[model samples]
Target: MNIETLTWGTLDIKDEQIYHFPKGIPGFEDDIDFALITVEDGPFSYLQSLQNQSVSFLLSDPFVFYPTYEFQLPESDKEELEIADLVNVRCMVTIKEELESSTVNLLAPIVLNPVKRSGKQVVLHNSNYQTRHGLWNVSQDHFEKGGE
Candidate 1:
């Protein structure tokens, strides 16, 4: 379906790309549907809202930046997203900007269940991870290193 995006002028996404967030992404409780799109050869991507064209988030695989980053999928989140195997899950972090000084949200990773076409932003409640981890820490040889 065709959608007017917050970043991209307009986009046509496949039905398979659509994800339903029943509880929404924390503060965005009213916006439930979204489409994941890649940023043309770049490490970044976007989680664009199908429900509200104006709402979109620039995302990136946090692992590429902080290789040590990890989190447990609270059973509540797993049930909510209907997540089964680890292969069925994908993680994307919010990229605040492109500058080295910019930050990425590592504490709350957005998890999507491709098999169920559902998603949720799993907030790591009591972790040392921060919401604004500097982007400069990203590995310079991203392509040389494999990704999930």
Candidate 2:
């Protein structure tokens, strides 16, 4: 199917690539359907809303930056998505940038079921997690070790 994307312009996406968020993202409850389009040569992706042209989120896999990160969602949420196995799950964190620092929302992650084409942004109850986790910390640590 062909869709107009903000980052990719008019592009073709496989039907299997479409994701449905029954309850939608926290603030974007009305926008349910979306397609994940990767940036041309970047690690980021755009979670573009199928219904709204202006509604899109920049997301990145947390593990790409923070390999040690872990998250657990309530069992009730798992039932909502019919998540039966880890293979069906894909986790992404929303990114934010400021003049001084860049951050990622690790407390709430957008989880998707590629097979079911459904998704939900789940907020973890873990007290150890924070809404804004510094992405720079991970970068600095990697750089210090001569790793990219």
- The alpha-carbon deviation from the true structure for residue 139 of candidate 1, after best TM-score superposition, in angstroms, is 8.9
- lDDT tens digits by residue: candidate 2, 53-121: 788887877777677767666788878887888523234544445523566676787888776778888
- What C-alpha lDDT values do all the predictions have? 0.75, 0.72
State the lDDT at 123 in candidate 2: 83
lDDT tens readout by residue for model 1, 9-110: 878999988989898888889999989887887678788888888888878877777777777778888887778885232344543455666777777888
Give the root-mean-square deviation of each candidate in angstroms: 5.3, 4.8
Clashes of 1: 0
**Roughly what TM-score does model 2 have, to 2 decimal places?**
0.80
lDDT of 1: 0.75
Worst 10 residues of 1 by lDDT: 139-148
